[model samples]
Target: MEKKAAEKRVQELHTLLNQYNYEYHVLDHPSVPDAEYDQLMRELTDIEAQYPDLVSPESPTQRVGGEILSAFNKVEHKIPMLSLGNAFNEADLRDFDRKVKQAVGDDVEYVCELKIDGLAISLHYENGLFIQGSTRGDGTIGEDITANLKTIRSIPLRISQPMTIEVRGEAYMPKKSFEKLNQQKEENGEEPFANPRNAAAGSLRQLDPRIAASRNLDIFLYAIGDFSETGATTHHDGLNLLEKLGFKVNKEREKCTSIEEVIQYVQKWVEKRPHLPYEIDGIVIKVNSFVQQSELGTTAKSPRWAIAYKFPAEEVVTRLRDIELSVGRTGVITPTALLDPVRVAGTKVQRASLHNEDLIREKDIKIGDHVVIKKAGDIIPEVVNVLVERRTGEEKEFLMPTHCPECESELVRLEGEVALRCINPKCPAQIREGLIHFVSRNAMNIDGLGEKVISQLFSHELIHDVADIYRLQKDQLLALERMGEKSVTNLLAAIEKSKSNSLEKLLFGLGIRHVGAKAAKTLAQQFGNMNELKKATREELTAIQDIGEKMADSIVSYFENEEAISLIQELEAAGLNMNYTGPMPVQVESISSSLAGKVVVLTGKLEQLTRNEAKEQLEALGATVTGSVSKKTDLVIAGADAGSKLTKATELGIEVWDEEKMLEEFNR
Candidate 1:
């Protein structure tokens, strides 16, 4: 029980447990029995408790998770996590191959890896010790999930070589783990996860790392963020190096000398996918040589040297038992097809979106009709078609309802729109949906105010509007079905915290007709304050790029409404912050007019500034930042590894500027 003896024992336990963990979780071969491993872990935990100073983050006991996180902090990826282009057919693969060969020559080799159907993650190591891990948020930025990621036993706390590195991978839940977890969920009267991918994602995103640790997640470290540190010549070499460093590299990867061989690998996996212990949606084909990859370069979004060959969607037929209608926040009535329960794309599907009345009518969907369904992009189930031959004579033709299903208001199809809409401002369904949107993650982000709680509050008449949420009493919440003292306290604290959010969150939470998160940010930056925004005319609003005439009209009309003005005053009275808290907008007169009125697009990674900073700078200099390149694009700021946008810019004969040129222009 002495400090010296405890320290030595802790170190020994670390070595033994880490090795055993690697053997069991990564290598799938346990040299020791489960009881033995557990006993050692318990000893380590007890020793650490006895000599608290001897405990370290690298200890095996730390894998069980520590404290709960209040919020996930934003992490900027030093190397951008660029997405791969996808190929759905043999022709697409051949096309990708031809392009790769054309750019890097036919002497190229390709490494084929299984495209894991899970969450993408980046792991950062400093001198071989796992420092941080994050989700692939918007490529350049991600949410810090180090605590959650540490729970995955396959992920080593320390690498072998004691070198700094950033590696990328896919974190997943195995089929067995997913089944067991879902079974537990069902037994507990909780909704089971739709698929392993969803379950994995949900586990990793949990505010409590203990929840993630319980999920039994796994990972496969595939690509190194930078291979220069290890002197790896090829993608295959990098994978081998990762494996040597105590990382779980997928052993199913193959090195193909030709595109034909790559095609065979893809085809082989397509047939063998169902048998794998974990789910794989596709095969990722990458040019093997690092030199060739550099030669080929990337487009705006994806790499030219790599493509993911997505498996064909699984299709199944189910009976459309009934048509269900729901009212959206915008009062648009959406039709959903309630079908007989069936499994497709590794998930149970009992409902598919019918989109709108036009889609329903065009497909001629009827009650009790057998319909073919498939997952679009392996997520949303949709009605591919109807099997007319299998339709029973008793099938009833469906029609769009003439009234709002919730509020009993008459529905009308607005001009230039195909769907029926309920214009009733006070409709209970719209109010409920709007409240849900207002408290969403991208909006006010009140932590414990979930959809279920919101629905309960609405039904109980404890909250009628978003502002009413702030006025909620603790006693009122405590009286609700599931709201415990702790739950009510946390909910109230979260609601209080949201009142201090920047103007963009408030603007997005308002649910303006045509304004999205991006547009909301833009507006917040431009106007600086809610008072200025309220005074903006249609002409002034449209002058800002990305704001169209329709959007401008919507904004102007929204501000003119007395009810909206009253609601804004109410929110302001509730101690909500009204000023923009982000970077200040550049003054028009201070910057050069050279880029004035030009449609500009930024691509790839910039060394000096983030994509957003560069975008704001460009916009301040009178350049309009757009996502895509077209003939209308006046200029393109191409950065490191610039992808398809750069190619398209060249193809269209548009002006292209490198980072240096852009910086020089900004200086001028």
Candidate 2:
């Protein structure tokens, strides 16, 4: 095809795909099947590949996201995003209504919309084209997350008309998406996000846009930031306009004629909130008319015209059957309350975490006692309080175990720590948990070694520790239940592949107390080899950045144990790599180094090295990279859309550099 023909085809494809995206994401009605969408996308990608200049920012292909960002640049909101005051009861609602009536007169109406439990966001569009998106940080300033926001399909890239406006919405993970994401996180041995709101916030804030895209996030535009520019006389009208402009708007909103009607709406939703597809913590009540809202005025932090009615946490009474204790890989003995199965926040409740012995005593919970239970954050089940009035003399007081539940080793509470720990390295339960951690993604990354598989192997006595994994034979794995020939073969291959992992993997897999993944990587780079690290004293370990006294002591104590020595030797005998093969931490101490002795702060997006890479580079040059700007900070590396950090640096009269200047120094 000719260049002109291809260009025309590209334009046609863009309009078609945008429509499809709006239907599937914004409208929740997809006209074309996913396969057809992919085919058209492929065709457009081919045309763009043949002609690079044809690739535009607004192209449908740009939604896939770009390379990892160095840092999020900050954005200052043109119109400060005010938060809403909350109403917990009818009295509070009446108080809010009274205030609104006092300011705007007796005739008033309220628009009630679902208060989405998610991250607040600001989307900016230029000439009907989506340009930038950011968080509502501190109301006035936010982090620019345009690349990440673009990945959310519900957000339209273009509107119906050529208009520049800022829209506010809540970016949330649906209940189903949150559950699926938590399942994946658990399978990967990662802590599950507390709720949909937190999960959405964490996903959107990820420096890698690809990570955010994978989380399957959605959004609902509620209010326009610049209400006057939108020409909407009422809050309900603004929502309609937003929907007409190709933005996803929640359809469950209602316009109530009076305060009593508003209260009724809130009461109705409080019971039905859990049934919704997504999580909503409360309902937002706003005076309907723009004139009424303006007349009602605002507080320093919240708008008097609008208030949030938070749903009271649903609590249920269940019998506490028993208190079960589980030993973690870190040897922390955590108590769990085993309760009669009851539903809370849409999930069945069986067990809730009892953080420490102090909590148990403070709550005065007893076995056989009726207890109130609720989902702590609509995700984690927790014991709220005991129904002492219903408790009879038949209830038995629960006692904390003095010894490890699995290994029977004496438990001890460490100084400055609330957890009772079993410090014995050879505890059977600890070994099993450690093996599970060893094959985790951040550790050895051994495929096909899930907790179930690891537990099976542990039960059969085929694997005792991390080293025993490398020594496993095909015959032994085949003997296990459900371990087929192909399964054993694949498992062996993944195990063999992990043998060549850099020293950091092995360091983390060792499960040394207080040594997390980051610290393990630092130690691996600092020592360059396991033997060097094993020989390092506490003083030598503490010399590394981010390594504090506790971590240094733990590392020295871990390697000093006889079992630790034997494990390392066994690992080496099985032909595992023991050398650091990643980017070495710079050890240059030259006084003339450009970034030497400087307390540097990095902010915004860098096109070249990643944020961690940049930090590592600066550290190598003897620069201390701090998270925030202070009077002690000597320089600030500013990239595109640098926010509060850049402003503070300027105010402090500190030196600032862009990515280009930073790279210039890096090359030197």
Candidate 3:
């Protein structure tokens, strides 16, 4: 009788958990407090443990939480997670409404919610417990980020029901959090994150849950999938049911009885969005009835039942006081518009990148022209379209300089490329930028060696070329600002450590034209070492996949240069690795597997394993680990809340495996 009673309790817990999951994931309405849900989950887990026979496959306690994944395994989505059709203006919205009306009749209701400006994620829940989370990568596959998702405070560890469900939502960093993070990064002498969206995206992609946790990410579940068993006749009812669960739904969501109401809501939010703590790019409008949505169906890339109404870009008219030319590390000469101070997109706009001479000519922008400027993606300030009416005859046509701005060397525009480049290897500006790039995170990854330190080194004549970095003495470094004995030692140690890094890093650090990180890695791996690469002719170089003739010529020319030869010899003499060393070995077999081909995402905090170690282990095993969870993900290794990825995965019916099971498979 006791056994029977316990079994009955488990079943009850399962049902409750599924219902709550549906409420939270599908409908985005979580009714219960997180604590109560957690308590119930603990009880269910205890009951299941006491009577192992009573535990079912769909139990809420069986999520992927026990062991942290060494890395996420990729899963290909059966169905592509297509992008939404956008409604940029009132006319577009009206057209969308008309289409919906034509398909589902004029009586269709609408649900409007903020279109979050972070990463789009999918979550999968089975039997009411959170499982896998993924990014919307190419809509077909994405990295599994189950571990990172588990760290979100608002995401529930378990659900209230035993039904399998999938939910989708936007994962975003609040504006306040973004600001604080940027402040801290600046204080630490790190480059500040460009925008809230980028910050959120970057934070979510981190392999370590601890790093993700530090970012303070948040989410709002919006849609439900696999809802046939729930008897939710309409989207509105499904949302109501979701509210009864334990998910965090956006409070600003509204139900509109008609398209007019939806438009009104969208309009209202466009004005009211500035007051919100998070960045919202637009409003998502969807048909509220499941029947109506089915009737409306979908297009190649978007659902006919829903449309995103993008807010008009914020534009402000400002005077172009002067045009400045700046040379980047890559030797690309960019034109800058120094604007009269104006605020656009909640940020002060003082300068904007003109991109190149072609853009300047295309826009016909002059030094004294009154222009309208706006921030694209609310991050990069750009001159959209010139206010031609405001242009005065005094506005002079700006011409690019025929010579290098710094060294006055004759500039040459390479064929097939737009911008003119200064080929002088010793140009002071280019050298400074090159040094900074060499020590950048993606390059040598030298800690404590930043732009300021490089500048100081250059000023003191302690370093001129890239090889000079290897020759820094302790006494010389100690004389620099903020440098002490310990700091100097640490810097030296870092420099020494970087010397042994794979040839790919060294190749990237060289700042060769058109050779990005991936290209450098490919070149290193294909050639085996710098010597082989330098010996290869242009024809041999271009034979590799993805390397074009232009890239080949550039690489050949760079290697042929006497300065480059000297630098390589000096670096080789300093004990820097000049050849490819294959991939890093797996620290333990438990992290390597056939799962290497799969993309894996880690969401929540792990009781064991650092995120970096896990990523390394996975990579060594031949798997590609990505930060975002998308449809292409093979599995979501979830822990805790697991946020949007968990919801999206469930919606897509993707399989989610627990950490213990993953470990067992790996061991097997």
Q: Number of backbone collisions per candidate, in order? A: 5, 0, 71
How does residue 43 of candidate 2 score in lDDT?
98
Indicate which candidate wins on lDDT. 1
- Model 1 scores a C-alpha lDDT of 0.88
lDDT digits (tens) for residues 281-354 of candidate 3: 89988888888887877755568888888777778899998999877776778889999999676555789999
How many clashes in candidate 3?
Answer: 71
Which ten contiguous residues of candidate 2 have the minimum total lDDT? 604-613
Local accuracy of candidate 1 as per-residue lDDT tens digits, 1-668: 77888888888999999999999999999999999999999998899888888878788888766689999999998877877776889999999988888887779888999999889999999988998999986566789999999999999999898899999999999988998998776543245777798899889999999999999999999999999878899999999999999999999999999888998898888888878889988899999999999998986666898998878788998999999999999999999999999978776788999989899889888999999998865667899999999876999988888999999999999999988999999999999999999998788888778777888899999899999998999999899886789978988998999999999999999999989877898999999999999999999999987888998999999999999999999999999999999877565567567987788999865634457767876887877787789888999998755768899999999999976567656645
Error of 3 at 165 (Å): 3.7
Candidate 1 global TM-score: 0.77
Q: What TM-score, over all chains together, does every model reach?
A: 0.77, 0.67, 0.69
Computed on alpha carbons, the lDDT of every model, listed in order, comes to: 0.88, 0.86, 0.77
Candidate rank order under TM-score: 1, 3, 2
